[model samples]
Target: MFGELTNGRYVTLARSDLSRLLFERIKDTTEIIFGNEIVGLEEKSDGVRVRLKHGGERKFDLVVGADGLHSGVRRLAFGPQHQFEKKLGYAVAAFEVEGYRPRDEDVYLMYGRPGRMVGRFTLHRNRTLFLFVFVVDSDPLPTALKMQQEMLREKYEDGGWECPRILEELGRTDELYFDSVSQIRMNGWSKGRVALTGDAAFCVSLLAGQGSALAMISAYVLAGELLKADGRHQEAFLKYEASLRDYIQTKQQGAARFATALAPRTQLGLLFRNLVTNAFVIPGLARLVIGKEITDAVQLPDYHWQSSVI
Candidate 1:
């Protein structure tokens, strides 16, 4: 299975090919409107009032709040973030770098801290993506890459292949994303007809390397539930929540554990990591720690395309 990615994300799929794949796979009549920000939601007897910015609004059979973390629709329907989100006290920012590689490098390299980890991976054919994450107190605000560069240098500057290189290249990109990795644990993700989906329902901290997968899978399930509802959006929302709750809970719990792994606090923590990494020779110990903890006793689900689902 592929690992999770955050920064400098690129997909190898060519523009036309990617568009074709998406169209063929999801050939529903679901119209996608861009740049529309949801400002408010008022539930009606049969549907929900999906109010958009600049006074545009619409009614839908179902309003799935897939807006993402800091979900605008979430607050409009439920409440503020404080009502659901629990911050783990860390944040991250990621962006691409300049000419740091051979201009043809497409492999990945990464590093980790107790509360943070960074990685890079192949996008498609020729481009490489860079990702960076760090867990810090305060906001450190570092505010910008120049500050992050200073900070990274203070911590891991001595003789690294890319620490310095990354710092130098940090100036090239103006599209950096920053946010805290907190989990959303709600007693109920649905109220009347408006329901939360994806990161709105449960944000499996990026620490678990499964945020994107969860988003994709959760959306698929939600859409399926809607189809099953046949028109009963509320029932579908509740059923979707009930069916996916256990999995979401398990994944979030795993994310908390991952946070600990990234930032080992003690000598024992370091030793424990090494032991797990080398557990093959230790009899049943591998099965005890690494297997269960890392994998969560769960295998990645296959998402092979079936002509029917689309």
Candidate 2:
């Protein structure tokens, strides 16, 4: 909402590498399950019985749904997907390609057209990441990755800037994360022994640039509450929801509005947006408005841990 180029401290990387790094860090402690999905959940007095699509059934004291917007756990526990999803009338896709580095590795370059925006960031030497966001009128989203790629090519093939070049690299990339830009909002994120977190429970979407961090924070609070309650999940779930609801609600609404404004519907609107953003939105102002304040939003509790080893 300003007229200037903004600067902020951000670490850019290829999404695939980021995923790999996180998995490696957690592999030792968390059993890594692949090619299986939760299809059914039965809540019992002491624990939840979970049925898997491929693996055999198992039981756990708690099931925290940290899946993305199309969460299977959320569907099984809450309801069908339609009841809680609010589409922001847009779609986004990202991939890696060769040789499109920006002059300053720290600076992210973005190009915008009416109803569409494309961003390029340097990942490392001789590698770059391309991000595409555009207005879409589809519901339930396209299921196939190939179909999503085709849609992007059709939507941006004729556009100026690096769009055409990026489209050329579509079929060559190894994988793509493509989805409709939507948020998940629910009246209640917990039921009995099961609770939801991250994009599964309350996704503010990428416009806010705070999903992953907020998700980690939610998990921290949830774990802390469980410890405080001595594993009484009912009370822990209550405290977890109460602590996170207002903060997440405010974030989700603000992000939806910001996403809408990010992509203008007409060429004139796009021009006006660019002019105002470049003319007045200074780096200092940008940091003040959207940067430092994000990390400072929540005040975490100091939990006193009792000795576990007797």
Candidate 3:
């Protein structure tokens, strides 16, 4: 699937490593205030007033919510998350373990049953990442890590193919990423001097397999539009939404189909999915089947950014 889709143009790195790489590039120029949260935002005639959790207030020309799906900025600016969130009837969890045995280098191994699927991929430094996707019946999922782990164990304890061993390693790890597969939909990405970007604005969900890429694209477009607008944030926010709203909506629609494809709810659906995956071996069929999904159709504008502005 990757061979035909990516055409050898993709690299997989741990999310932490990617964050570190980006931070290194901007640390000198950017002021990063860790251990603080945005508790409130008040828009003014000229700028937005940001109230931090630590009892500090700062003003900025424009405030952007680049935060993820459960974005605090989005809530403060747009309203409650429930208003814009659309749950995709699925849940996903991922964790990595070091020195896990039975590693398949550069190969993504997957096993699926009705309503559930597990995938394993090797990473650098003898680390193995495991991803679990399954159908969910309700929302307000457990927030506690121990409860999340117990839920996964209940769902996969009787399963096959490394389930037991993976659960064993799960006990030893403290970091686990778990969340519902949901997308953010909004009529607008901005409210006054406050604007949103990345998953905070429009998340295509985890099944889309392009959240990171879309997030980067959104940030790039937002930055470029802001630069072109010359500090007029209202104009920049409108342009940013115009540039990516339709494209992001298309991706979100495609991602809705992926939830069922990843973890089919019935035996017939699972059989059909397997048949389609097996058919990928046929020459040019994979591309013909999923060409539109793999290809990015949006033409990014080349904003001639000045070095000083950057």
Give the number of the best model, judged by lDDT: 3
Q: After superposition, how far is residue 234 of candidate 3 from its true place, in Å?
A: 1.3
Candidate 1 local lDDT, residue 274: 48
Per-model root-mean-square deviation over C-alphas: 5.7, 3.5, 1.3
lDDT of 3 by residue, 1-310 (tens): 6666667676776667878988998899989988889999988898889999986899998899889999999999989999999998899999999899899999888888899999999999898999999889977889999999999999899899899999898888799999999999999999999888888998889778887788889989999998888888889999999998888888888788878899999989999999998999997897788767766879999999888766
Clashing pairs in 3: none
Per-prediction tally of clashes? 5, 10, 0
The residue-by-residue lDDT of candidate 1 on 210-236, one tens digit each, is 665677677777777776777777788
lDDT of 1 at 220: 73
Highest TM-score against the true fold, candidate: 3
- Give one digit per residue, the lDDT tens place, for model 2 in 1-310: 2222122344444445767988987787678899998999999988999999998899998999999788999999989988998888998888877675344575567788889888877666677777888898767668787888888888888889767668878877768978878899899889988899988999888767777778878988888898889978889999988998988887887788678667877899888777755744454655455443244467888767555510
Residue 187 shift from truth in candidate 1, angstroms: 0.9
Candidate 2 local distance difference test against the native: 0.79
Return the TM-score for candidate 3, rounded to 2 decimals: 0.96
